[model samples]
Target: MSDRRAIPPHSPPSPCVNICVMHKTRDLCVGCFRSLDEIASWGSMAPAAQREIIDQLPARRQSLKRR
Candidate 1:
């Protein structure tokens, strides 16, 4: 039997829900709640930066709900 351990994901999964529309006034993706710059930079961003953005998603979604 081989001793194997599950490997963790290399990077944070994207926030894209494939609903790729941008909010006109808010300047955030209505689905993922990320700004255009954030979206564009996602692939190049470090894991920590990615996590920071992910951490903000809930609050961003909540704020959108208030609109």
Candidate 2:
């Protein structure tokens, strides 16, 4: 199942940083990782808006995950 929801004309942007830090337990970044606020905000973002943020995630996440 997905966490799809309603979106408005404007949506929040990506929360990322060039400096990444992967958490040992979560296998996610300690730095530049999405906060609870961002996740909550996602469902209200447009598809195109979500895509824009998502596109940068994989590379950034992968870079951290690799370390």
lDDT of each: 0.92, 0.62
Candidate 1 Cα errors over 4 Å, as ranges:
1-9
Give candidate 2 regions above 4 Å deviation. 1-33
What lDDT tens digits, residue by residue, belong to model 1 across residues 1-67? 9999987557799999999998888999999999999999999898889999999999999988899
Q: Of the candidates shown, which would achieve the greatest TM-score relative to the real structure?
A: 1
lDDT of 2 by residue, 1-67 (tens): 9998875555445565654655665555566654445456778777676777677666766766676
- The number of residue pairs in model 2 that clash at the backbone is 0
The lDDT of model 2 is 0.62
On lDDT, the candidate that comes out on top is 1
